[model samples]
Target: MALQPLPILPIEVLRQAALSRLRAGVAAANAPDADPSALKTLYIPRHRFEKLGPERAPLLHVVAKTDGGEGLSHELPLVASVGTLHINILLASGRAGAVDLDVKAAQLTQAVCLLLLEDQTFLEQFAYVEALRVSMEDGIARGDGGEFDVVLVQIELVMAEGQTQFEPRLPPNDFAQVDMTTDIGPVVGSDPPQDHTVRLRFEPEE
Candidate 1:
């Protein structure tokens, strides 16, 4: 049998696409009862994490930065594990509106996982072993912000080998690190929340 090439996607491209979908979901969930304007902006500060060990191990020092020129801010840990990619989101702070932002955010995370698995290129490289592992730790916020404290969203991706008997045979397990950052610009600071949407695409890695 001819050897097949491994499937892969540009980390940044995938991250952006996932972020866009997340924004869309958030907007849809928070649509106004009356006139609905397009979702204009989203801001995802630079986030970082430290690997603890294996799948069971916990990630440490996950942080999110804001353009507000504040000191390094931290949030609860969120983790996700796919084939080989582990994703985590740490939310620093957010404007609490009427909409269930946390639930919408979780949905956004799942959407990203679905996209990664459905994408043939990504699957080829890192087969969809199972739903990405997700965890949302208790978050905290500071300053006289709106409603919610800085929410922390964390995701972790794990790559592992699987049985070949399955229709989609598992590929070699390897580890790679990728960072996803999203920026939704300012929105009207009001009640009932504002609606915002963004579309993003993913491309194969070169």
Candidate 2:
């Protein structure tokens, strides 16, 4: 049989795929609200998150790094890679005319989880999603500025394809013949031992 090419999903591709879908979802939610304080931006930070300022508030940070694989076994060619994608929802606690930071965090977290669940296209990019979890806490943002309420959402992908390296092709099974022998018990006094032997040809099955 002809060998087939291996399947692979580069890490960058997975990260970007998730970022695009999330950005789209946030945009869709923001448009209808039409409120100046409504969440506006979702992005993958190019610099250290601590260096970012308050202007980046009402933002979502998508982090997709760190993963381990179900290593290949039994001479299998490939295996799945699994990991978590973290979405950090940040909002300024004291922004004027805005809802309570706690309320905003809950709303944002709900929207994020719903979008990821309802949007089937997102899952098409990977093998499958294992589960999603969310938590909230206070965090310092942008130098010594006021604390921002943060919501963390973790999405665990059970198995993603194309992330593992493929094993080299196995050599063909080729053997020509087999030989066998059996030892028999000796008689009470005279015979030391008895033996039986046989040989057979081996042919590859069609």
Candidate 3:
């Protein structure tokens, strides 16, 4: 018998799930009085993503500074190093096409935070922890008409000695190094190939 392919959710579904995870983390960090039950009903339209691409945007592309908002400036106490995480999600027309989602760094950071919360053991392995910072940078185009949605997530582990203050700093490269791969298979009824789930793994430099 032929093997059956696994079911993959829609891109919008995945996006909403990711956003939910982000909201949960923010609530846990701050606003203990903030009702999570009410928060779940909060829905930010996809159009808000456009604000993230504008020049001189705020630290995080979130609408408010509340716990449910983007946790961009929250600092984590590190032992001896600075750790930075980034998450980027893009929805393009198709492969070989222009990038519709241009916020690369910020998206990566968000993904990293989600990953950390899901697995606290991974965080303990590191020596130091500091403020979690995320940024979105627009990428240059190689061609016109052609477009692709790409999500890049990155985590940076900066090693340091004892008594080092973990300040929120941007990577000199403007963005953390990233490796992209598909977490979920192609969509059920899509032309060509469309990955419903994209996974980005981040490893700090030695």
Candidate 4:
């Protein structure tokens, strides 16, 4: 019997996986100790990102901006997602400088890219996306706050997501069937050349 392939993930799952991984990467993240707890994850509602309250000097925000693709295609569910990850670098005194931010952002990018290349991450599926990529978009100043440098990471995710099935294990077969063959009737061109028949029967050990 032929089995159906697993269903592909919905658009939300694909987009959300991208966002979640990025956020999780920065949450209590361990890297470049000079910026400890400085490289934290940020999440604001799409409609209110611009209205975020007083955020710390150094913070990273990950957002899934758009989900656009053939919901169901290629006999499987596929999604094209675009996301944004912003790294806020503190430019004020007694805090991290542009160099520090650059180092952290580079480190963060490497970590997230490794995640994207994975087939299933921590029980979530984004399966090896051949078309996955991250773009560094233009950064701007946060006019509402003190000296802050904005670093944006434009995330593009494209992959067919599916679940994993663990099949049952079967016991080994130790019995081998024995077959017996017999010929009925004389050989061809023999006396009268009677009809010939070869019969095969399987018999188990008594």
For each candidate in turn, the TM-score is 0.36, 0.59, 0.26, 0.43
Q: How far is candidate 1 from the true structure (C-alpha RMSD, Å)?
A: 29.9
Off by over 4 Å in 1: 1-84, 91-96, 127-131, 143-147, 161-206
Residues 89-198, candidate 4: write the lDDT tens digits: 22212224435555555665565566545526633544334355656643446445554555555445554444433344645655576566666767778786776767
Ranking by TM-score: 2, 4, 1, 3
Scored against the true structure, residue 167 in model 4 reaches a CA lDDT of 43
lDDT of 3: 0.39
Q: Which candidate ranks first by TM-score, i.e. highest?
A: 2
Tens digits of per-residue lDDT for model 1, 121-196 = 5445433454345767654444444334433445655443232221345455453534454656545785656555
In the range 129-196, model 3's lDDT, one tens digit per residue, is 44444433344322244433333322332311123334566566544567887667779899887879
lDDT of each: 0.41, 0.58, 0.39, 0.46
Worst 10 residues of 4 by lDDT: 86-95
Candidate 2 lDDT score relative to the true structure: 0.58
Error (Å) of candidate 2 at residue 16 is 1.0
The per-candidate count of clashes, in order, stands at: 41, 2, 18, 0
**2 versus 4: better TM-score goes to:** 2
State how far residue 36 of model 3 sits from its true place (Å): 20
**Better-scoring candidate (TM-score), 1 or 2:** 2
Per-residue CA lDDT of candidate 2, range 146-200, in tens?
5444444343433344356576874686765545545454545656544443445
Best prediction by lDDT: 2
Any runs in candidate 2 off by more than 4 Å, and if so which? 1-11, 30-51, 95-99, 140-206
